[model samples]
Target: MDVRFQTGSKRFNYRAAGILIEQDHVLLHKQVDDKYWALPGGRVKLGEQARDTVVREMKEELGYEVHVDHTPWIAENFFHYDGHDYHELGFYCTLISNQSYFQKGPYHGLEGERLIYQWIPINELNEIVVQPEFLTAGLRRVPEHTEHVIVEN
Candidate 1:
């Protein structure tokens, strides 16, 4: 049911991502074998609004019920990964959660230990490899208005 399609070495994806920042840190996740981190979210399912995708992914991935605070970016990204050329459309949303356990630094999500989640201090983001690359600097100064970003990597 994910909004993605593949054809002859090319793929297209529709995704929704959430930004959860608390106490000067932002939540990021990556598969156990991956080297880069990305905002916590997943593919947008068919017929689901981007906002709802954020809420659903958080609960499914981290067991946290989140509310969408605001949408900050819609990105169109072109990249090659895992042997496929991909064109991805992503909706970036800010999220708010009342869960206190999330403050405990790093942990694995509800789906076992396949994915690793951590809160990286905002100031130290520049030291890590964040996907889209723009986020390394852009996350430090979230725009007040919704911005459109196009990245080719």
Candidate 2:
């Protein structure tokens, strides 16, 4: 099962996200009704490695097979959403794929229109709302070494 649980009024999650950048653009996705976007990934399943999670999620969500290039960050994200206080541990991994289909334009993911995927120009990230805030600047300059980021929102 996915690594998520609730205790009292707070919920905790362990997620793995992939950062796919190509041709000066970065891939981002969100639920059609949501106002914000985030890297494409999902909760890590039990007994799964983070890298494996990235590869699995990409194929499952985007229909593209990908390999993990490297891990850049392990983020401790805190926030409130849908009335629950959340404590999330996120593994942010850089990804590489041979498929060029996503480079064309915005497309609906395998989940139909509920999830929307788009390649946004990296330079224009300032115009859109990317969650975890740190990623707005972090994606512009990915650190050579893995970083431990604590984001409380």
Best by lDDT: 2
Clash pairs (backbone) in predicted model 1? none
Model 1 off-target regions past 4 Å? none
TM-score of each: 0.96, 0.96
Taking all chains together, the TM-score of candidate 2 against the true structure is 0.96
79-115, model 1: which lDDT tens digit per residue? Answer: 9999999999999999887775356666898899998
lDDT of every predicted structure (CA atoms):
0.91, 0.91
- Candidate 2 per-residue lDDT, tens place, 31-149, comes to 88898999999999999998999999899887888899899999999999889999999999999877764566778988779988999989999999998889999999998789999
Residue 122 lDDT, candidate 2, scale 0-100: 92
